[model samples]
Target: MWMNEKIKASEVELTGLNGEDIGIVPTREALAMARKLKVDLVCTSLMSSPPPCRLVAAADAKKEAQAAKAKSSDRVVKVKEIRLTPNIEEHDLDTKKQQAARILQAGNAVMLVVRVQGKEGAAAKVLLEDLVRELKEWGRAKTGIQVSGKQAAVQIDPVA
Candidate 1:
């Protein structure tokens, strides 16, 4: 990204503002040419014998980089977790379902976890299966119900 006087090389393989090859030239001459065009002399590749340089407007490069950053940020996906118990009441389950639906509509994945304690361990698996079936319209299960210690969990992703 060395530009203008910041470039330490004495010579470079230059490309014009319009991307036309200008061949190898002294760094001072390249700087003068860039000055004439009101652009920057940026060192693009330093691996060659004569480092490759390009004449480009600094403002344009900055704008392009900002646009790319914004584009990448917009495509970020988040995973949201909703925890429940096997003996959760009907009203609470409905509330959780609504929250999961909202998260799915916003383009996020959901991890459903049913925490089991003592005698509740066996029934938690059945509860998780029923929960998956209930939410089938909003999302598809990415993983089958799995038991890890005292927790039964499944991951679901929003339907495309």
Candidate 2:
């Protein structure tokens, strides 16, 4: 997004202040026009052959870009991780469950991982299954509890 004197293209496909296409014009000419209108010469698309440039107020363009970025960020789904131990106490489990519920309500996936030692491996799997059942109203298990060696994990996605 080159602006003003930073635009390197010798020619540009110009769009006027009112969004009217001004066809391809020399870069210097476009800059002159923008200067006359008291707007910045913004190079909108650098991939095109002539590079598309537009005449717009710098502040307005900045606000539009920020708005677009914010809108895009809102749709991004993140995976929230909650780690637990097989011998976790009842109170601690409840705390983790509440945390997971909050993450699910925010439209994110929660991955519950339980680490165990030797004989506690089986307990870890059972613990994850019970947790999933308790959180069923807020989120559904995306995958059944997966147990491998000393770890058990399950992914829960927000109920849509």
Candidate 3:
């Protein structure tokens, strides 16, 4: 309700695009007004004893938030998964390792998983350990064991 910004409240206030305060009105009245203006009733302060809510146009409000998030944003780090095996061929392992490294360099986290097949499942622990060690070394630039399980996982953050 940027068009109507006379609302105000100390215990609660109206939040508009870019965290702007439009003003505060009664909960029911504010929401009704927001709906009339085709806006959203968003809570800006949830920790306040009574919490504060804001009336903002859903589309415009979201756009502002997205813009804010994009500004000085960390490259949206996504999880890139790579499956491995203990008896994996050298060439295959190296190829996967390189792929994972590339993902890390691109600013995405990498999740490496080692699956143990029948018969080989007995040695799955040793296999996972070795693979994890290799990946940790190669990904030392940005690496951490995020999860270790029957099907283990390793996370590598951006190199920078």
Candidate 4:
């Protein structure tokens, strides 16, 4: 964003501080107008025949950019994953369920993964069904149990 004396363009399409078009004018005259308004001549577009420049306070532009950055950063959502085995003990299952419930309550998505090995592979489907039933109160399953090799997985999102 070339501004003031740093702008080497001979002519520029100028816009007023209030965003009204001031048409194309010599760079020197634009700089003089910007100085009179107590604002900087910011080069906004360089692709036109004469680069487009706007009269604006640099501080205001920086503040607007910072506000936009903060607003964007606040909307991020996180996905949480919980891993389980087909033979998971009752107490362990309860603990995992609590963790998943907390994640769902916080408006995050949860991925339930059931790992099976050897003989347990045949029971993976049943284990996943029970897990989905137990977690029904917390969230609805977005993806039905999908088994791939040694693992079966389901994705659940918050109820509301």
- Please report the candidate that would top TM-score against the real structure: 1
User: How high is the CA lDDT of each candidate model?
Assistant: 0.87, 0.91, 0.61, 0.84
Q: In order, how many clashes per candidate?
A: 0, 0, 6, 0
Q: Give the total clashing residue pairs for model 3.
A: 6
Per-residue alpha-carbon lDDT of model 1 for 18-137, expressed as tens digits?
Answer: 889999999999999988988888886678879999888979756755776788777666889999999999999999989998998888999999998888877888887887898889
Candidate 3 residue-wise lDDT, 66-148, digit = tens:
77677858556688888887678878978987897677667677777777555565455565556556656445424543334
Sort order, lDDT high to low: 2, 1, 4, 3
Q: What is the lDDT of residue 82 in candidate 3?
A: 83
Measured with C-alpha atoms, the lDDT of residue 42 in candidate 3 is: 61
Ranking by TM-score: 1, 2, 4, 3
Report residue 18 deviation for candidate 3 (angstroms).
19
What shift in Å separates residue 43 of candidate 3 from its native position after superposition?
22
Give the C-alpha lDDT of model 1.
Answer: 0.87
Top-lDDT structure, candidate number: 2
Model 2 accuracy (lDDT, Cα): 0.91
Q: Judged by lDDT against the true structure, how good is candidate 3? A: 0.61
Scanning candidate 4 in windows of ten residues, the lowest lDDT window is 60-69
**TM-score head-to-head 3 vs 4, winner:** 4
Per-residue lDDT over 38-156 for candidate 2, one digit per residue giving the tens place of the 0 to 100 score: 89898877888899989999788788778777887777679999999999999999999999999999999999999978889888988998999999999999898888887899999
Model 3 alpha-carbon miss at residue 24, Å:
18
- For model 4, what is the alpha-carbon lDDT of residue 14? 93
TM per prediction: 0.56, 0.56, 0.44, 0.53
Question: Which candidate, 1 or 4, would have the higher lDDT against the true structure?
Answer: 1
Candidate 1 TM-score over all chains jointly = 0.56
> Candidate 2, residue 55: CA error in Å?
25
